[model samples]
Target chain A: MDFFHVLVVLLESTIRVSVPLIFAALAGLFTERAGIFDIGLEGKMLGAAFAAGAVAAVTQSVWMGLLAAILISIALSLVHGYASITQRGNQIVSGVAINFIVAGSTVILGEAWFRQGGRTPALGEGARFQTITFPYADSIREIPILGPIYSDLLSGHFILTYVAFAMVPISWWILYRTRFGLRLRAVGENPGAVDTAGISVIWMRYRAVICCGILCGFAGAYLSLAMTAGFVKGMTAGKGYIALAALIFAKWRPFNIMLACLLFGFLDALAIRLQGNPLPLIGQVPVQLMQALPYILTVILLAGFIGKAIPPKAGGVPYVKER
Target chain B: MSTPYAKLPGWAEYGLIPLVNLAVAFLVAGLVVLLVGENPLEAAYHLINGAFGRGEYLGFTLYYATTFIFTGLAVAVAFHAGLFNIGGEGQAYVGGIGVALACLWLDQTMPWFVVFPLAILGSAFFGAAWAFLPGWLQAKRGSHIVITTIMFNFIASSLMVYLLTRVLKPLGSMSPQTRTFAEGGQLPKLDWLLAIFGLDIGTAPFNVSFLLALVAAFCVWLLIWRTKLGYEMRTMGHSPSAARYAGMSESRITVITMMISGALAGMMALNPIMGEQGRMQLDFVQGAGFVGIAVALMGRSHPAGIIPAAVLFGMLYQGGAEISFEMPSISRDMIVIIQGLVILFAGALENMFRPAIARLFAMQSRRSAVVAQTKGA
Candidate 1:
């Protein structure tokens, strides 16, 4: 392949890998910005992925699967919200329980329903997400840098890829422009003040977590339908956690969260490229080294580079009625 | 109609909580069996019988307890320091690998006694080192230990997968594992000691490791309650600012607390590595480190409490594994459901039941009081 071909391949792969993370990061942004720590995002996404894939496989309708996935995700989110919000239980412990629940339950159910032993049957073409190519992109495919980048990176991805990118702007608009956004931030920063202003702190948190659920549903759908075309055991593979890291790195800003996702996505893309193909100079960087990139980046960012990425003051501290 | 039961102190509080906790634990375990459409009584019978009915099985259960004791204590120690060390998996993996490597390298050349202690110590060092980084970051840079510890778990598991498959390939097999250790690397079995207690060591794999775990637990209790450092750790756990005001370096305590936690977790490999297996392999401890959190929680995060909690888990784990073999359709995941329920109830049910019980007793006493008042009138 020519230099252009390699670049085009690289660009497309980057977009593909980055989409789920974008959704997850944005989901995390909503929850954390509202001042709730959601380490359970991974569980939510996995549960959604399994639900979506199983529904799609059985119904042979991608739309039905997507809807089911979102509903299940929201249900699980409500579980987290109820435990951490209503009961004043420890959020971290609740999240951990949810993780264990999802991990074990999905596999158990998957094996029972499909008999494939913790994996769903593959989707037929009609049931899988079809690529939505940009019209006339072929005509501009011959053009220089911007044209190649656009066609390779931006065009021809599954519909959700566009949605994932579009979400950043939408998230920014909602977080900054809307009254709900203000209330959400206020609740996160100080629920006591929000309550004093006569708003229901509980309602604001519920809404924030609901938004998180919807976004996580899309993230899970993107993983099953768009990214892998089928669900595998533990297939989300800590991307949810990585997205969480991105959200923190971005300091809870939607746009910065997107950027963080892309950076990690690029590292992942590079890792995959390096995997099976040895470099001419370094004789193939070890797969282990490549795999460690995102974690290494996360550690560095968390340690110092992103100075004072302050969590919402009320984050993870469940708001009690009397307190 | 009446106020809640007055709070008690001394042994009454200490003795009652665990008894109540165990009763609740068993009740939930029975409910799970019922949910699965099985006979609760029979299942409980089988569960107990399967775990301890056979001498070999009983030995395995105790050996399992040895692993739980170590990891549970590790989590308990961290809890005392107000740090949740979810990186126990990583610490255990690193420690396991270290011991395996030590055993492989030192077995033939070194004396049996020297090699065994060195292997255990080497593993502990590796575990402590693994935990040190996250602790240091939390102390020095204000990074959250939760995320970092989780990331480290992924790194450790990935590295382990890679090393086992590629680097540490056994003598001739392509499968993912190292060679079994030499006899010298194995933990010494006190056959005579077991004989004195009228127990056989041959089938049990019950060795010095169990005693070591008990000693470790006792030491942990002493460290938390008796030592100055323990006092500092407790203060830091309660309030970092208070600790600082009291002349404790919060950063140093954080790092040292994690190291202690890591070292305790490191000792867990002794069960699988130096026990019957005498090898490092896949699913060696099998999420015991994570389960340790539940043990710690159930035990109320104390060294003394953790022993019973560890034994409780060891029983469930043994029972669950045995059931999976017979109930092919049920899958081993029934254990996960039971575990989740245990945790849910362990954390929530106490809060729920205490009030209801107090109300029940209050009504009975109030009725008697009304009768007395009427008679007096």
Candidate 2:
């Protein structure tokens, strides 16, 4: 293949792989903006993936699987909300607990329900998200650069991929332009001020957490029904953490989040492509190094080697009403 | 309306509350067992029996507990300094490299006794070094330790995989592990210690590491409760602003505390590498570092409580393995579920029952005060 074709393929795969990261990073943006540190994003995504895969396999309805994924993820989010918000507990500990619970429960429940060794049956075509080919893709292929870019790179993506891309602008509008978004951001930065304005800080945080749940649910469904045929054991495979790194790397901005996710996704695609492939001077690049790049970059960014990425002022502290 | 805050007595605060939380965790776990279509009571019986039924079972339980103690103390020490050290898993993993290097170098030349101390030092140094960057980042660079530590975990996993597969793997070896260590590298089994109780620890990997764990626990207690640095750590943990106001260096304490925690976590590798596996291998830590979080929270970050909590988890692990053997439907993941529940109840939902219990205590104290007034009248 020519260099251009390889580049197109690489970018296409980057978009495909980044779909989950986009969903998850947006999910994190909502919660972190509302001052709730949701380390449980991994667990929520995993739970949703299992639920979607199992329900889709059993009912053979993609809609039902999506519904199940959303519900289960929301339920887990509420558990986090209860511990961190209502009980005024340590948010990190609550998130960690949720992660562990979901990680263990998904396997146990999957095994018990499916009898397939912690995996659901392979999903049918109807039960999985079908890719949508953009109009005029076949006829436009005769053109040189733009034709392949339109047909191969942009077209023939699963619906969730489009939805993930669409969410960026919607999230940007919701976080920056809307009234609720303003309140949510205000609550995260200063719950005391939001509370003084008679807007309920607790309710604002709950809403943000639920929004996080919805986005994570979509991320999970994308993993099981859109990315692959079915859910394997531990299929999320630290993508949630990568999403978190991307979120931090982006400094929790919607457009920046998308850019970060795409960057990380490109690294992932490159990692897979570069396995055992020799470069000009470097000889063989270790796939592990490629895999570790996003995290390494995130750490470097977090260490302020690049520009500073400050979290919300009240990011981890639980608000207590002082009489 | 919220109930008025009441100061709890030491016994209720430390002992009764934790027990209640533990009971709730176990009850939830039982519900999970029932959901899996098994007899919860029967599972409980089997679990207890598997942990303590025979000398061999007890030996295995203690063997697991030894690893937990090291990790638990690691978390607890960090907790004392108000830092959450979730990188125990990575630290422990890197610590294996230290133990392996020591053994690979001295195993064939030196006696076991001479090599043991060097291995301990090597593991501690590597573990501490692994943690140092995150600590420095948190202290000097103003980064969150939690995120950095978590990032370090993935980096450690990748580094270990590279080392084991490409660098450390012996020539012509199919497996991604080093060759078994020589006799000097192996820890002597503590069979005689168990035999003194008129019981044989048959084929258990229980070894001198158990005693090392105990000694470490004692040392941790001395460090935390009996030293000037311990007071500084406690002050910082209680209130960082107060610690700073008192002229304690925040950066120094944070870095030193993390190194101490990392050293303890690193020592955990000895239990498996020297005591049991006798060689470095992949994933030998096996979530033990995470288990330390549960142990520290359950034990209230005290060495006195950590030992018992670690042993309880050891029971759950040993028992869970037994249950999986006896029952086909239930897997070892059941223990993980229980562990999650324990962390949830004991760590996060710890205050769930505190208010009601405090109210009960308040009422009792009020009643006694009224009776005393009537008697004085």
Candidate 3:
């Protein structure tokens, strides 16, 4: 491909790969904003993906499957919230347990129910998301650079790509402008202060966790229904953790999170494209090197190799009533 | 006036929580079995029997326990240093690689006496070196150890996958594993010792690794309990500022602690490669490092305490395998549920039961004070 064609493909690939991460990153933002640390995003997303894929396969309806995934992910989030918040348990341990539970249980159930080792039967096109086209942009293919870029690169993404982009703005507005957002930030910073002002800390945290669950549900749907047409064992492959790192790298800002997600998505897309492609200049980098790009980025970002990023003051510390 | 009977002494205060934690853990595990449509009683019976019912199985349990003890100590050491070394899995892989390379490349030329110790040392060195980068980042750059170590794990696993698949495969085998080590590289099993107790059984895989594990545990206990360095680690884990004020080198301690933990984790591969496989395999150290976290938590991060905890976990692993065979319908995931519950209960009850005990003590003291005051008045 020529330079312009390569550029268009890169841009298109970036948007496609970034959609699920954007949803998951926004999910992390919602939980962490409300003063909760959610390392369980990966588990919730995987659980929902499995649930959505299996349900959609059986029901032959994508919407119903997506709804089911949302409900199941929310239930798992409740388990996480209750264990960490209600029982005064360690958030990390609770999150890790949720991951193991969902991972092991989903595979076990899949094998028992469908006689598949850890996968659901792939769904037909109608049962999965269809590519959404902007017809006007398609007609503009005759125009110069902007038209070609917009029409050729961006016009035929899955429906969820638009939604993932839209979520960034909605997340920004909700976190920065609303009364609930203020309370969420306040609670995260200091639950005692929020409680003294007559707000219930428990209820607020539950709301944050639920909001997180809903967003993660969408992320799961995007993965199972939009990105790929089915579920496989450990298909998430640590994307949730990558999203979590993106949350920190972005300093928990929605806009920054969007940018961070795009950067990671670009690297991921580049890696995928680079695989099995003979690049004349660089010779051949092992596929494993490309797979490890995001993690390497996370360690670099975490090491303050970029700049300082601070977490919420009360993150991971569950509120306990004092006598 | 006498101290109130309601209050537990210090030992009971520390000891009772773990027992209660164990009870709650087993109860939760039993409930999970029920959820999976198995008879909880029968499953539990099989679990216990599978672990300790036969002499051969018991040897397997001990062998499994050896790995846990090493990894658990590795985790506990870092825990004492107030560092979380999630890279144990990766470090262990590096250690395995080191042993494999030494055996494959060097064993032909070296004497058995030199090759064996060199293999152990090589494993430890690789593990320590693998951990050192993250430790350096954590100390020098203020990177969070949890994230850094986790990243290292992915890198390590990816590297191993590449090596096993493309680089390290034995000629003509195309399989994702290594060549069998030369005889000089193998560790000798203690069949005669077990035979003296009339319990020698199994396929001669049981070896001196168990003794090495216990000795490592004892050494760690000594390092933590008797030495100034151990005291500093414990203090630093509790509070960095306080440790620094007390003259501990934060950076030095971080690096040293992670290296030691990594070395200990690497030692685990010695058992499997030198004891069982006589070579490295793809399925080597599958999640044992992660399981070590649960073991360390359940053991309350104590060396002495970790022994029983490792044994408990080893039993669960062995029995989990056996139970899966007997009841093919129930997925082996029932073991993970049990493990998750054990970690949950142990973590939760540590904070939960402490205050409850304190309250009981306070109430007893108040009652005694009231009696003493009335008698005096």
Candidate 4:
């Protein structure tokens, strides 16, 4: 392959790997920006992935599968909100609890419902997301640089991938321009201030958590329905945690979150590409090390080798008006 | 509005509340079982029987408990220092490296007594070293311990895989594990100890590691409650500024607390490596380190409390294993849900019903007072 083709392939692979991460990062961005620590994002995504796969397998409709995934994710988010928000419980513990619950329930339910080694049946066309081609994709193929860029980089992506990237701009706009976004940010930093302004801190947090759930739902669906044919056990893996790291790396900003997710995505893509290829001097980097690179980098970033990451002022502290 | 239970009579606060929470958790678990179309009572019976009915099963339960005790104590120690060391899983994983190296080196020539101590030291040293970086980062750079520790877990997993496959795997062996340790590397089973108690428990994986776990617990209690460093850790946990004001260095305490926690978590390898597996392998720590969080929370971060909590989890694990075998419909994941429910109720939603319970007590007291006044009148 030529240099340009290799570059296109790498970019395409990065985008593919990044879609789920983008969704997970977006999911975390909403919740953490609203001041809720959402370590349970992994569990929620896993649960949603299983639900989507199982539902899509049964109904043979990707849309219904997406709906089921979103509904389940939202239910989990509400549970997190109830424990951490309304109940004024320990946020980390609540998130951890949600993680365990979903991790367990999904497998149990998946086994009961599908019995295919804790996986749903392989999804056929109409049940799984189909790649969408841009208009005039054939005409654009001979257009040189722009042609390959359009066809390889932009076109032939699962519809959900486009939505994942599109949601980045949408989230940025919602977080920066909208009143709900402003209130959500304020609630996270200073819920007391929001309450004094006659707004419901509870409601604002709830909305943010709901948005998180929706994004996580898409992320999970994209994993099982688009990225793969079915939900295997622990399909979300550590993407949720990686997304949280990306959130912190980006200082919880939507645009930066997108960049952070892509960076991680690129790392994963590179790992996949370099699996068997040995380099000069350094020889072949172990696949395990490559898989672990993002985490090690996250630790470095968190250690302030990059820059200080200041969380929302009132992030883990529960808001209590009476106190 | 809530004066009735005021302090909940100390016993009720610490003792009764946890019991109530566990009861509620079990109730929820039963409900889930019912939802899954199985008779909750039947499942519970099988679960309890499978865990404790046979001597061999009891041995397995104790074997599981030994690891939980170590990890739970590790988490509890961190909790006392106001740090959440979520990297126990990672610490334990790297700890396996220390275990393998120690066993491989000493097993050929040394006796079990000498090898055992060296093995324990090796595990703790490696595990503590694994945790030292994150602890140092948290202290010096203000990095969040939870996130850093979590990231370290992924790093540790990858590192272990590389080491196991490329470096440690026995030559000409396709398995991703080292050769089984020499006899000197193995810890003797506690069958004799069981016999001393008049119990005819069959020889099982339960071994001297259980005794080591018990000793570790006692030592932790002493360290936390009796030592000056423990007092410093507790002070820092309660109020860092105050600790700083009192001439306690926050950074030092944080680092030292994490090291100690890591050491405790590392000790967990003894049971799996020396007592059972007799060799180093991948993912032996499993989720025990994570489960330790729930154990510490349920145990109120006390060693005395941690023992029973650890045992309870051990029962759950062993019972769940048996359940998966007996009831193929209920996958292994169901145990995770049960564990999750217990953690949710006992830790996160711990205070959800506290005020309501307190209110009920208050109302009863008020009614009793009124009755007393009427009788006098």
Which fraction of the native contacts appears in each prediction? 0.28, 0.69, 0.45, 0.83
Task: Please give the distance, in angstroms, between residue A101's alpha carbon in candidate 2 and its true position after superposition.
Answer: 0.6
CA shift at A147, candidate 2, in angstroms? 2.0
| A122 Cα displacement, candidate 4 (Å) | 1.6
> Candidate 3's residue-wise lDDT over B76-116, tens digit each?
99989878776778888878987887778776677556666
- The pairs that clash in candidate 3 are none
Q: Looking at candidate 1, what is the lDDT of residue A243? A: 88
TM-score of each: 0.90, 0.98, 0.90, 0.97
Q: Give the C-alpha miss distance for residue A296 in model 1, angstroms.
A: 1.4
How many residue-pair clashes does candidate 1 contain?
A: 0
What is the two-chain DockQ of model 2? Answer: 0.82
Residue A147 alpha-carbon offset, candidate 1, angstroms: 5.5
Question: Best lDDT goes to which candidate?
Answer: 2
Instruction: Evaluate residue A167 in candidate 1 and report its C-alpha lDDT on the 0 to 100 scale.
Output: 95
State which candidate, 2 or 3, has the greater TM-score: 2
Q: List runs of model 1 lying over 4 Å from the truth.
A: A137-150, A280-283, B1-46, B161-173, B188-206, B282-285, B347-377
TM-score attained by chain A of model 4: 0.96
Query: Candidate 1, residues A1-323: lDDT per residue as tens digits?
Result: 38777867876788789899999989988888887888888989998999899999999999988998899899988887877777666677777777776776777678767878788999999777999878787889878887777677777889889899999999999989999999998889999999999999998999999999999999998888777777887888888888888887887888888898988888788888878888887786778777777777777777987576777889987786662
The alpha-carbon lDDT assigned to residue A276 of candidate 1 equals 83
The per-residue C-alpha lDDT of model 1 at residue B344 equals 50
Model 3, span A235-291: residue lDDT tens: 888889888878888988999999989988888888888888867898887888877
Distance from true location, Cα of B201 in model 4, Å: 3.4
- Candidate 1 - CAPRI tier? acceptable
Model 4: how large is the Cα RMSD against the reference? 2.0
The deviation in Å at residue A279 for candidate 1 is 3.5
